[model samples]
Target: MSFISIKNVWKYYDDNLVLERLNLDVEQGEFVSMVGASGCGKSTFLNMLLGRELPTKGTIVLDGETLKDEPNADRGIVFQKYSVFPHLTVLQNVMIADEFSSAKVLGWTFGNNKKLIKEKALEFIQAVGLTPAVAKYPHELSGGMQQRLAIAQALMKAPKVLLLDEPFGALDPGIRNDMHELIHDVWQKNKLTIFMVTHDIKEGFELGSRLWVFDKLRDDPQAPNAYGAQVTFDLPLAERVNKNNVNEIIEKVSRN
Candidate 1:
């Protein structure tokens, strides 16, 4: 069985259909990159995987069971915008993730528990190369540094799946390249199943083991929302294949 199964899924907000017939199976440790035009429901699909949203018609299964209709520590997400606490230091921001999981009511830990969480947070901070800014608040950090902090916070949960919604979209070209390397290292070191939505086709090809293109197979001009988008292409980025056809894949993704 697949590690994550999305079978015959469809999403709707009222009468506006968003996704139609999204059937795909994702294996563990596979880095799947999603690309498509804006408003094509890429983020919505990621939300379903994270359990923040439910399919209006179908179901999403994770680890052999149906996914719950709520967010949990099993899945972590980092958005394009920094999802950090502005009031907290870098260390505190990462530590709070564990606190929320361990001490739900208080959202804080004490004594040995606090010490362990702090140590773990520090480890992740270092892994993301943010140890220098451990004491700085979000407002004091650069865009790339803030995003790194966000990545550290997500990894603090040790999630089975990592969902990234254009996590590097806001960074400068140099900073974005650095982030790409960092994420690649993190994914390999942790053996994480990652689904990233990217507008950059080149980034998608460079980072993902597999690529998915979401596009509308049918369109009704009279009623735009009458039909929704689906997976128009699924490409496996094998080393040789990717090296040989990078431009071809980019062209295909860009045409839609």
Candidate 2:
């Protein structure tokens, strides 16, 4: 079975259908990048994967079992806005994520495991190239640095799946490139499945081995809410043309 599966899924907010007849199979440790226009159900898709929302029809399965309607430690998420605590130091933020997850699973504080927590937190901080900023507060760090913290905090829990919602969308060009490398590096070492949502097709194609393009392909003018977004293409980058050609392919996909 696929590590993550979405079969005949449809999502609707009240009467507004957002995603329709969506089926996907994500292998473990594969990076799947998603691209689409705004309000095209990308965020809704991620929310469903993370178990924050359930599909109105069909199933979302992980490891043969259907998902529950609540967030769990098996999945970690990082948004465009840093979700780190403003009052906590970088190290503390990373430490708490691990503690929180463990507390949920073990039904007790990992407080006794503080010594190990500090060690693991530091390891993830350095993994994201933030060893120096460990002592600084969130506000004390630059935007890129804060993002690094967010990545570290998420991965510190060692989640099976990581969901990134345009985590680098707000960064400067230089910093965005840096984050791309950091994310790839962490993905390599952590061996976690990833589903990232991005507006930039170049970024999507660059980051993932499999690319899923989402767009509204069919609509009725009389009833705009009746139709919903669906995958236009699922392009595997393992055997493909060069970078420019790959971008060209996605450009064509986006246009159609």
Candidate 3:
């Protein structure tokens, strides 16, 4: 069985159907990217995987068990907006994640293990190339640096699946490229399963080992929602890594 299985899922808002019979399977240690225009149910799908939103129909299973209604350590999410606490230092941000984990396993007094928690937080911060910024607050860092901190915080939890929702969307091109390289390196080092939603076709091809495209048509009023969408294509990561093949896939998605 796949590490993650999303079987025949459907989502609706009031009477509007956002997703119809959507199904996906992600293997262990795979990097998959979901690419489509805005409001095509990309984020909706990620939320379902994270168990933040339940499907109106069908099931989402991970590691042979159904997901709970609340978030868990098994899944970590990084969003376009920085979720760092403004009042906390970089070290504090990551250490707090450890504390949360410890609290779940131990008790609420995880803050007492200051030395051990600090060491773990520093380890993840250094892994993400943010050693020097550990003492700084979120406001003191650049946009890219803040995003890196977010990534570090997420990784500190050692989640089974990492969900990135347009993490580099707000960064400049140069910084975005650098962040992409960093993410690729992290994925290789940890062999973590990753799922990202992106609108940039180039970035999707660059980072994804497998790509899923969603095409939505608005012209059909008879459709359940304003957006009548379909899962148009699925391709291997190797094909996308090649420049020519990447362009071909981009063209194909564009035409859809």
Most accurate candidate by lDDT: 1
TM-score, structure 3 vs. true = 0.93
Off by over 4 Å in 1: none
Instruction: Tell me how far the alpha carbon of residue 27 in candidate 2 is from the true structure, in angstroms, after superposition.
Output: 0.6
Tens-digit lDDT track of model 2 for 1-256? 9998899999998999999999889899889999988899999999999999999999999978899899888889999998999988998898986666567775335455877888988988888888988899998999999999998888877789999999999999999999999998888888889999999888888888888888898999999898899998898877434765876796697787
1-256, model 1: which lDDT tens digit per residue?
A: 9999898999999989999999899999999999999999999999899898989988898898899889998999999999999999999999997898789999999999999999999999999999999999999999999999999999999999999999999999999999999999999999999999999888988899999999999999999999999999999987725466778768767887
Model 2 lDDT at residue 19: 96
Clashes of each: 0, 0, 1
lDDT of 2 at 26: 88
lDDT of 3 by residue, 1-256 (tens): 9999988887888888788777778899989888987888889988988988998888999999998779988999999999999999999888887776667765334445877888888988998889999999999999999999998989888999999999999999999989999999989898999999999978878898998888764457565475545577877777447676667768878888
- Sorted by lDDT (best first), the order is 1, 2, 3
Tell me model 3's lDDT, rounded to 2 decimals.
0.86
lDDT of each: 0.93, 0.88, 0.86
